[model samples]
Target: MNGWNLAAAVLLGAGGTAALWGVTTGPPARRVIAQNMTTSAVCPALLLLSQGYGRPAYVDLALLLALLGPVGTLVFARLLSDDLSDGPPSARVLTWTAAGAGAAVVLAVCVAVGPGRALVKLLVTGALLIGGNIIASRALADGFQGVRGG
Candidate 1:
């Protein structure tokens, strides 16, 4: 594969591996964050793959995952609210790091594609990926405290 593909492979390998480990061997709260991370990791890799392979399908997949993955995490967080009542997990560091990586990858891909419908889609995907990620992380940390109080 080319450099893009290789970059994708390395990212998937490193991020996926770490996320997998965290998910499999942690408390429910930690596992939920790890699950969110799965999306952060894979979405960027998918973008890289899409660029490397010159296939729009991979971008579509990345977009779908970027949109859905956080929803899934929020659902899990809501379900596990009891476990998180103590306080929001201290995951800001991890969350921002993952978000940063996603932003970087998206910027790289956007540069490669230049301006077009594809660029628009990439920006949307990146926005959703980073925006959704922060939103989901906040929900996880807040654990519906405001909602429950109201």
Candidate 2:
């Protein structure tokens, strides 16, 4: 496979492994954090795979994931509000790391695609992914009490 595809594979493998381990073996808070992480990890890999496969459509899927990831996390946060009420779940290092990776992948894909509408879409997706990651992380940190009117 090409460098892009290979990179995607490697990222998916390592991230998927870590996320799986985290989701399966941790407390409810940690598992939720790890589950949130799964999207951050996969979105960029989806972009990379899109670039590698020469499929612009996959970018759309990435965008969808970027949009939905935080919503899903928020739902989880709402459902488990009691479990998380003790304290917010903060994984700052992992959160920023995932955001950085999404940014890097977006940049790489943008470079490969050059200036065009595609670039704009990629930028939006990246923004959504990074923004969503930050928002989800923060919401979890706050235990989403604001969302629940607390």
Candidate 3:
């Protein structure tokens, strides 16, 4: 336990240092964003590292988060872009589809590998369904409106 705690502390410290460097090199707004992301990454990693000592599941969670971190960050950046209204309809559809696919993949992986309950998996699936509806309904309605006007 002592060793695990020590390792976690060291990893967190290293992550903080990297975050500091990232912020210092980026623009003002970017610096803040980068710092926040780096910090988010670090806390999860440390939590997993610490939990790895008792439960291996945390290690798997950490691995998934590490793999998906960039995707989340990119989504955040896209949401904050200045020209959000100008993207092509096809491009928007592709983006939303890809995000949905990614979520599906994650849910599948968690179900297959983790020790979570059936209810949790069902909840995740339900959330994905809701999210998909929210995203696609807007575009679908817009297309319908366009056709009606024609």
* Best candidate, lDDT: 2
C-alpha lDDT of residue 72 in model 1: 94
Q: What's the ranking of the predictions by TM-score, best on top?
A: 2, 1, 3
**Better-scoring candidate (TM-score), 1 or 2:** 2
Q: In TM-score terms, which candidate is top?
A: 2
| Stretches of candidate 3 exceeding 4 Å from the true structure | 17-29, 32-44, 47-52, 82-150
Q: Give one digit per residue, the lDDT tens place, for model 3 in 51-105.
A: 4365544544444444455445444334433322333122345334434534454
> Against the true structure, candidate 2 has what lDDT?
0.92
What is the per-residue lDDT of model 2 for residues 6-74, given as tens digits with 9 covering 90 to 100? 999999999999999999996789989999999998999999999999999889999999999999998
- lDDT over C-alpha atoms for residue 29 of model 2: 91
- lDDT string for model 1 (1-150, tens) is 899999999999999999999999967778888999999999999999999999976799999999899989987887778787875675999999999999999999999999999999999999999999999998887778756533
Ranking by lDDT: 2, 1, 3
Q: Write down the worst ten-residue block by lDDT for model 3.
A: 82-91
lDDT of 3: 0.45
What is the TM-score of each predicted model, taking all chains together? 0.94, 0.95, 0.37
Clashing pairs in 2: none
Please estimate how well model 1 matches the true structure, expressed as its whole-model Cα lDDT: 0.91
